[model samples]
Target: MSQTIVALDCMGGDNAPGEIIKGGIEALKENKDVFLKMVGRQEDVNRELEKYDYDKTRVEVVNATEVIETGEPPVVAIRTKKDSSLVKCMYMVKHGECDALVSAGSTGATLVGGHVIVGRIKGVERPPLAPLIPTEKGGALLIDCGANVDAKPSNLVQFAQMGSIYMENICKVKNPKVGLVNIGAEEEKGNNLAKETYQLLSNLEGINFIGNIEAREIPEGKADVVVCDAFVGNVILKMYEGVGGVLLKKVKGTLMTSLKTKIGALLIKKELKETMKTFQMDQYGGAPLLGLKGLVVKTHGNSKAIEVKNSIIQCISFKEMNINDKISKKLAVKKEN
Candidate 1:
């Protein structure tokens, strides 16, 4: 844990090398143990790097001439764009040159590179994209948020197992409750996939599998790990974000509507801001593609400095905690049991 090296895609996000480089520098300044290998075009990355004042020895600029656009086909892009920032960063993680990769690039490209490049851990059917979602009690890890859209029941079962390990180690939620995302609370209420997954999870050892959780109950912090296929998980994630954004906007608008409310807002602005900070998604960093040989994290494509900084800082814990090794051991024991 002396130094955790993270390969960052500087040319992949909407903000590109500017914000991306800024985040990397911020992460270095924040975490004295982190060393960043920034990947992007030489001139672009160098230009951005000149603006930041940080330890010179801790930062390395890796040149990657090509850039992968979000519109490009992920599989094709990964194969063809050999010198793209995203692909180059993925390879660094795969080859053990870096402990992890952080990208605000194309989701499709990240997933594709993770599987096709970094590869999956053995005995893992499908690697899941698990992101911590804020809730009443704390945060819940939503597994398979945008990977494995057609995941089988077995995949969901693994998601629960992997997610439990993540919450326990990273989030420090001991014996985290795992819930199957479903329409009704009953075991027999969901479709074939949910019903089957529920049965499998109910009997799974080492995880605290709760019964079905309705969508409404998610915000209530009903479960620490919410398991579902990518399609359902993606829909729920998007809806959760959209609703949260609208609600925050509405509250801010209401606070400024009248002089009276504005005065009241001033009285409570500090407390309210502190409370709201807990619910911000960027604070949690990017979603980690679990069950891979090397860690691959995907942030929003429009990510700014804060999210990128947090994402790089997050890699230190993943490496120091030895998450991939823990996952391999957990799955291996489960198979034996």
Candidate 2:
């Protein structure tokens, strides 16, 4: 099998070269067919790389002189910070030097660089950031999580199509059910955007459109692909994360409150731990900006080694599945009809 070459922005995330490099090393250890071109300051990257005993042949360092801080304007940073790690890493994918690019960097910069550098798949109206959220039935893909805040009805339809393709091909969900995020389950519940989008999606070919999905029903895994405009999608994604964190902390606190509860906790600890693992966001890795010519995955900025490793590993499946080619073909067929 041909190796999957990935360019990683080692200096972009909060833990930076340290946690990022560790994650790369872990990915290499797990997947022999994956190779990494770690892009960052050569010396700083090497210092982190030296800490791990990894296959030297599978990993190489590409020096990037500058770093794009999260606060800087994305458009201006991409245009001016030519030597920044994020820009350099993105260019690697654009030039075909790498099959994919992974970054925990500035979301704005990643989004801008993905469009400007990696470019979008031909015939794709808009590329959406789609992330997998844990659900009762396993997981669901949340599309347009933060890419296009004000999207057109056509864009939402495209998001549903692209998201379905992703879940089926990469996540191995067959004929994945697609749902539109709305205030109620009824078809006529939402505003003009939702109503118009529902009509378009319902008429779209090749996807299993499952009407509207209320936010309350998301945890029950009512649909495999949840489609919405970026503003709504981002709100759901953030709230999902925040609520999960607080609930877990509260559960732990409650369990430790008294001796009787502590004893009960010990009895259920193993089972509880296994059940909780199902809801962890990091287990699924970062969200991919679907409809791009080359793969671009954006992890959380505060990601640790586990999330980093999972993000890199996530690229292997995307490359192996030839997701871009499939998306291009699907969109081209839609255009022809």
Candidate 3:
């Protein structure tokens, strides 16, 4: 059996060692072949770990001198906190000690560390944080969710290629169609950057470039992979979450207000619950930054133990698919000639 170990940053996030510990335990209980190197303060990790009966032999704590806070700048923190758990865990993956790295810390730090410390692929111009967004059909991948806010046309073109590769191999979307998030479907629409990107994507020979996709069609699952600059993509992500939250709250309030509605709710509650579960963001876990040298998953800072658990198990699929090697091979070909 192949050795699969994931380096988890336990010092970061609000839940820190507590939820991280629980996530590790759940991961091991679910997958006997995988192991975890929990990186954080030894005492804190041990304290939280004592609550679980997980395989102690399979879990080990890697100590760090400091913790990187959300307020600090990512570069300075990574450089100054040389012995910090966040930086150390990334090095572990960079040096080939682990298969992947998971963190629920500052998004800036994770993205900076992933691209700078672990380094990008051979020919990748930029690393995009591709996350699954809930859609009316199910969910779809949104590339450059928050990595590079201002990207070039070439950058968007590259995203299409990388996103295509991911959707095909990892996401299991055969010949995944690509769409450029734009103001309109007209070739003349959008800013100069998007228009230039349109030209590039239109010429691309590999991916199936579907024309411009409007934001309204997003819920209809018009495309399998949606590519946009970080600015727009981040807006779309936040809007989806906020809208879903508001809708759910309104629905719950309506059902609880009256006895008649309560009885009606009991009748339709099961269907509504299943519908809510289908669009649940927590169940999808975190987003993986594509085009990195190794698998680096960035979970939401507000993620609870259950979300973290699902995030770790997501790594199992990455390992089984050998995603990194496949990415490297593509980058090599792109770099050569």
Candidate 4:
């Protein structure tokens, strides 16, 4: 088996070097064909590495002197922080030193660095952040979660195309159904942008367009690929996460209300826990910024070891499937016709 090399930003997330290093070690244990280049302060990375027992040959520490904070402006930070872990990680993928780059740092910085450093695939108008959200049918790809806030109709068409490719190739959703986010299922039911996008997507070839889908039907898995501008998509994504967290807390509270309820909770604890795990966003890993020349995945800034580990492992499939090349070919063929 060929080895997949992933460059991870060790000092990017809320947990910083410790959790990131732990996740890398855990990923190494799970997949022997994976090699990781930890990018951050050499001393901090080495200090974390000493806490684990593993084959040191599979892991390399790349020194980065600075760290980009969440508060810093993305474009300014990426331009100014030449020695930052995030910038170095982006360069690693840009220069082909690694197959992919995974970071839990500033989302803005990651997105900006990805476009500025790694560049976008030829013929791709705008690269959108596509993330898999757990749904009734399995998982749905929410495109443009937070990339381009004000998108054009043509951009939506491209997002649908790239999103469809991702679902079919990466998520293994056969002939994935695509839907436009709107006020209603009717074709003429949205703002000027939505109406224009609906027409474009409906006439577009290759994608399985299913018309407009209401926000309420999203959780029921109305479509495998939900297309919308970043403003709307980001709102939906945040609401989903916020609601899921609150619901889980309420369930726990209810289970501990009284002695009888507590007993019932104990009886169904295993099954309930298993069911909850399916809805966890962390289990699905980070969102990939599609249409880029290389893979760039951004996890939550507050991500833990498990989320970090899964994010790194997710790159293995992305590399093996060659998603970036697939997107390039798809768009190139479309442009030719």
What tens digits encode model 4's per-residue C-alpha lDDT throughout 186-251? Answer: 988999999999988888889999999999888899999999999999999999889988998999
Q: Note the clash tally of each candidate.
A: 0, 0, 0, 0
TM-score, candidate number 2: 0.97
How far out, in Å, is residue 57 in model 4?
1.6
Error of 2 at 275 (Å): 2.3
Better of 1 and 4 by TM-score: 4
Q: State residue 247's C-alpha deviation in candidate 3, in Å.
A: 1.7
Candidate 3: which pairs clash? none
lDDT of 2 by residue, 102-163 (tens): 99999999999999999988998888999899899998999998669889999999899899
Q: Which should have the higher lDDT, number 1 or number 2? A: 2
Q: State which candidate, 1 or 2, has the greater TM-score.
A: 2
Q: What is the total number of backbone clashes in candidate 3?
A: 0
User: Which candidate, 1 or 3, would have the higher TM-score against the true structure?
Assistant: 1
- The sequence of per-residue lDDT tens digits that candidate 1 reaches over residues 200-311 is 8888888999889998988899999999999999988889789888998999999999999999999999999999888877777899999999999998888899999988
Best-first order by TM-score: 2, 4, 1, 3
TM-score of each: 0.95, 0.97, 0.94, 0.96
lDDT of 2 at 194: 99
Question: Which regions in candidate 3 have their CA more than 4 angstroms from the true location?
Answer: 335-337
Local distance difference test, per candidate? 0.91, 0.92, 0.85, 0.92
Candidate 2: stretches off by over 4 Å: none
Mind giving the per-residue lDDT tens digits that candidate 3 earns over 62-148? 988789998899989888888888899889989989888888888888898998788887778898998887788766888889669
Candidate 2, run of 10 with poorest lDDT = 276-285
